[model samples]
Target: MSTVPRYIREYVDVNVDFDKDGRMLPKTLIWEDGHRYEIDRIKAIQPAPALKAGGQGDRYTIVIKGHERYLFFEHNADYGDEKIGKWFVERKVAP
Candidate 1:
């Protein structure tokens, strides 16, 4: 049996800040269970596809609690804020 973990797109509520030049800077994210995680720093931002899941967006390389993770901003999803779009993380799910 293949032991590779399955990934699912898990949408989360994110707090963001915009610069004067309209650049987005993500501050923190709240999970479905109300757990919050602060983004320590952004390593890089680039347009990439979620290979684990199934989507495409600007992937943000962020560090949280000394661990790095990819945070995706799928610009097409209308999650109450059309101007900002929705944020998601490729979460590992059990098969």
Candidate 2:
């Protein structure tokens, strides 16, 4: 049998803050199901590939409730997405 994708793209709502010079920082992420998670800290931000999902943008290595997770932001307006872009996370699928 073919193995299904272990992860699926899940769009989430994020609350962001910007520094005086326009540096973006994510503060919280609301799940698709309306659950909100506060980002405890941001460890790193850099351009990286999005594995298991095609959307690629700046990757944020953040800690939420002491649990580490990767969040992605896809800001390609060429795809006709929102001008402000969107955020997404990979949700693991049970076997």
Candidate 3:
């Protein structure tokens, strides 16, 4: 019998913002195909060591540009698992 490798879920960073109280807010994450999804549910968040010296540590956000849209993500403070916030491109896509 042949075994198939399990596909791992991947996420990309978008943007990060601070509340008036300075608490990090939930981030967004878009699909590889530029589809938008909500991450209304979060589990936990923790600080992590820098992957490398002077690497700015692991608390940061990322932006990904897709053919049809742009995706945004950032470190979350509600989930132990890594996740990003996402939204659709400002412009509408053509059918």
Tens digit of per-residue lDDT, candidate 3, span 1-95:
86543322244443446789975654555456776555443343344433321122233232323222222223355666654332222222332
lDDT of each: 0.92, 0.88, 0.38
Q: Which runs of model 2 end up more than 4 angstroms from their true locations?
A: 1-5, 79-82
Kindly list the per-residue Cα lDDT of model 2 for residues 1-95, writing each as its tens digit.
98785887788899999999897899999997888999999999999868876668899999999999999997866766557677899888875
Expressed as tens digits, the lDDT of each residue in 1-95 for candidate 1 is 77889999999999999999988999998999999999999999999999999899999999999999999998956667657577999999997
What lDDT score goes with residue 64 in model 1? 95
Off by over 4 Å in 1: 77-84
- Candidates sorted on lDDT, descending: 1, 2, 3
Report how far residue 92 has shifted in candidate 2, in Å: 1.5
TM-score of 3: 0.34
Looking at model 2, which ten-residue stretch has the lowest summed lDDT?
76-85
Enumerate residue pairs that collide in model 2: none
TM-score of each: 0.89, 0.84, 0.34
